[model samples]
Target: MLPVGHFAGPMFIAPDAVEPESYEVRYEDGVFSLSAAEYAVWALAHGDPDRVGSHRPTRQALTAEAEATGVTEPAVTIDALISDGLLALIEDEPAARRAFAERHQLMPLALGLGNQPSQLGVFQIGMPNTPRVSVGYDIYHMWLFCHRERTLWAAVQEIAGEAQEANDAAPAGDVELIADVDDLLAGLIEALPILLSTSCGFLDPRRPSPTSAPADDAAGSGDDGRGEDPAEDHEHGGDALVAQP
Candidate 1:
């Protein structure tokens, strides 16, 4: 079965600014008018917006649903969306784990502090080419952990280990700090889109290629013959002014 994966980046449907009948789609760095077929397929694929991270619908199921909804050329639309990078495909959990182990791949984007850095070391984190969001300390720590550990599961394990170590080192009477593995993993998965929405992170796919460059360099290759702002050359769209809000 071909399992559909959650979008690696941010995608939201909102009212179109000009067209009353059409909808606006904010995907990655570009804003485009949404098509009925696209919306239908997307809605069918993402049954519940809140649980998209854990959900992986098969292409066939989505196509059948789309056909039921009267979406013309359902298969075509689904394939197009996947090709456009708005959707992805993975074989299964075991396959994903194997690929991840071999590649140690995770987020392909970079994180940066928002315009206003907090005085309490709680700076807002986001991307340079998109609006920055205040994702709080925990989210920031998770991103840092992923960056250091090179994978989400590994990061969670490392954090859990640290919590255990902290509790072990505490005095006999002191309260033990607890880090629930399931809760931490769930929270991280939930916050992933927010991180991706900021354009500060993305899911790294498994493929035959050279090792990745540094995140900072990936964000903006100052020299190296590439443009000053790497966001300018994004595959999906051009550079967008980072919203100050």
Candidate 2:
């Protein structure tokens, strides 16, 4: 089975609908049999879907509900639920599942700097000697440049011209020629990842399900292809252009 955090993709089912049967959780050893309700509780508390809230149940609420339902121990029920993947536990009460979804719906892209140009440009432009720009950087600029590269370049040229004129008119070192360079780069970086992630087919489309086989057996029938590792193929299949900032 895939490791817990390795499957960080969004849950395909709604939080309420994530019962144990919704997934097929298996163990490498032969000692566990988790029910649907149990799986649902466990997933809510421990799976990637539960990361936003860490799946912690409210103690007081759980106690009250358990008492009303005639259950002797609410904690035991909660533990059972966790084992089955039905519920989750989080550190902060304010960051429950609902709140977590509200706060962190998207996966953070590899880009680290802020979205502003002053922050993003230093990485996008690079040294100019490389043939292909970093995929990550190019993806951002390409999105911003969509149907407007010429116009954008023209604007940059105009700005550069203005900067040049200011430098010529002023005393030496008076004009900072690279003043707007930061902004220019940021604009490009801001848009690249959105474009690439959405359009470039770099990310896997399949939901990370436990039932999924490691590889497509039909496609890898021949000896030469059969010996190759599926995991390595998946990792290196794309040209993930890495740019050094």
Candidate 3:
């Protein structure tokens, strides 16, 4: 069974004009018209839909929020949303590392870094068919690992190493860099479904190709399939390894 942390995928929700207290939610290719009670449950689970990542809510928290909002049988409503693919229940970080990331290759659909320093490395990443999303620096850095021929865990280690090197001047402290990296990895795992569904990215079973060439070699290397941006116009089909929430 999937773990308890539930998160909503990329979606847009607006109030329904004809139906009072209802919502019209657009996710991927489908539209969900949610009644007030149902919307209450979903809204509680997904705070600030405009944010790039999904809101991670525990089951108990979701139920309590639903009850507070006067939604009856809140669990039933939450389950319905899960079944409808509007919400994905993510596994805890440890389990996700074992089951998802370690087993799948995170292939980007389109990834570009922000040009301005004020943007803090965040970028508008997109898939062939899905809307672009604002991804933060940490997540963006992690995604960059996809270009290299290494496991996601290896990428985490690399990131942690970089952090360690940057702080080398400071005396050794109790900070556990791996733990911090794991926390960031958890966010990526939680966002996996939305990433996969939108075709903004995918988790491949096959081994990744060699690390991409440097920017200077990009122009002429186009003839070599290895030079293509993984995110551009790549075909997306078949069943998703990760289930939609």
Residue range 58-104, candidate 2, lDDT tens digits: 44554453444344444664665443222333333322422222211
Which wins on lDDT, candidate 1 or candidate 2? 1
Weakest ten-residue segment in model 2 by summed lDDT: 236-245
Top lDDT hit: 3
In TM-score terms, candidate 3 sits at: 0.42
Clashes of 3: 4
Residue 200 CA error for candidate 2 (Å)?
Answer: 32
For candidate 1, lDDT tens digit of each residue in 38-89?
5456545544334434553567766776777777777876777675444555
* Cα lDDT listed for each candidate: 0.48, 0.31, 0.50
Model 3: runs farther than 4 Å from truth?
1-90, 113-118, 127-131, 169-179, 206-245
Model 3 Cα lDDT, one tens digit per residue, 92-209 = 6586575454434465666553435776455656643443666665666666665363456556656767766756645767443333666766766766544543445654332333
Score candidate 1 by TM-score against the native.
Answer: 0.42
Q: Which of the predicted structures, 1 or 2, would earn the higher TM-score when compared with the native?
A: 1
Q: Positional deviation of 162 in candidate 3, in angstroms?
A: 2.4
Question: In the order shown, what is each candidate's alpha-carbon RMSD?
Answer: 10.7, 18.7, 13.4
Kindly provide the TM-score of model 2 when superposed on the true structure, using C-alpha atoms: 0.21
